[model samples]
Target: MKIKGLKQLSRTLEKAGQSGFRTEAAKWLEQTGTDFLDLVRDEIVRAGSIDTGSLLRSFKRGAEGNIWEIEKGGLTLEVGTELEYASFVNDGHWTGGKEEVRWIPGQWHSGRFQYDPGSSSGMVLKRQWVKGTGYWEHAFYIFERLFEKRLNERLQTWLNSL
Candidate 1:
């Protein structure tokens, strides 16, 4: 498995025993709150007879990112959520924290995650967008950015009491 930030959030999230913001975020993202976490959670798509690259491009990544081949039929998605990243427990919750693109405890940390499903192998590719900080919650980072622009406009109008 590939592990990014071997010393920080990466390690924390992987731990079966929870701790800190990483653990909290996981719980929050799974079964609580408001934001659509499922859309941003780590994803693993089996080849499923479809062309993996084409399938990801069309249905998953939109138009960017590349695919890494693992085994005969296993393929890895450059983007997607790990189940632990955001458990089904909390699907629509707000991942609260400071810093944009930070490694919050509950959310999945950002990095260059790689998966080799054939061998049941995967690793966090978390290279922080910010400097100095180690691994941060990744799922939250993806959650905020993916939906922030849309939410802001809606919230502004709703809060106006129109």
Candidate 2:
């Protein structure tokens, strides 16, 4: 007896096992990244940090903002914002250096704080430090759990298909 179509069988198996797996994994990664982005936004909302919606919009996937790279059988996903004040909002900061109380030159209009150096009306903040909301941190913690569960399910499904 002679083996026939062994080369063809090998090629087919390679394509289905390797390339197919990579394709499926990439899809799952992209979906997870999108979900993670939404989670971060939700966390920010939960933290009551939505002021101008700029920071929220900054958390996107693509070359313009967040990092989303899937190449050469490798995957990389990062969700972040370019807004400078995002970190300040996520992490607490001192209102003023070595000052117990500081007068901020901002006016409150429509229940929103607006900074105006020339504004005569201002409010004094007596707190030395503002508490961090930790929205990003909380989002990451949630993502970790979600990612593990999703990965396991995807892998199991993929293996079953094979």
Candidate 3:
């Protein structure tokens, strides 16, 4: 008995391994990043966290003046946000002094909190904590599962083509 088509198989494998595989993988990774960003924006909207649409717009591609950044390279993907208040919105925070009662210089308009130092209207509270909306956290939780499933499907399709 003799083995046949080994040469063709080897050549195909080599070609795939050189650059084709990397290019395909990078494409899928970039797509996944885009999908993840859309998912996060949808989650923010679903959670009713849109105030001025700043956070929603921040989750996008590119680097200049954007809070969120999505970078893709050879078989690597990176997703992050530069907004400092994002964590606070997702994790919650205290309103004023936790140890002592303090006067908070802010005003409530139509059930929304607005910080105004010059405004005469204000509120006093102690150890008051605002619950986190968990929009980002929820989006991440959802995107984790989605990314795994999508990556597997994409890889399977690529491999089948090979």
Q: Using alpha carbons, what is the TM-score of model 3?
A: 0.70
Q: Each model's RMSD to truth, in Å?
A: 25.7, 6.5, 4.8
Maximum-TM-score candidate:
3
What is the descending lDDT order? Answer: 2, 3, 1
Tens digits of lDDT, candidate 2, 115-155: 99988889887756788899999999999988888899988
What's model 3's lDDT at 104? 69
The model with the greatest lDDT is 2
Better model by lDDT: candidate 2 vs candidate 3: 2
lDDT of 3 by residue, 23-110 (tens): 7876777788788878887888898877877677777777433543334443556665677766677788887565888676889999
TM-score of every model versus the real structure: 0.21, 0.69, 0.70
Q: Report lDDT (CA) for all predictions.
A: 0.35, 0.79, 0.75
lDDT of 1 by residue, 1-162 (tens): 977767665554444234333433343333222233233223212212122433223223223332222222222123332324222222332333333343322232375443434543443334332221111244455556755675565445433432
Report, for all candidates in order, the number of backbone clashes: 35, 0, 0
For model 3, where is the 10-residue window of minimal lDDT?
63-72
Better of 1 and 3 by TM-score: 3
Number of backbone clashes in candidate 3: 0
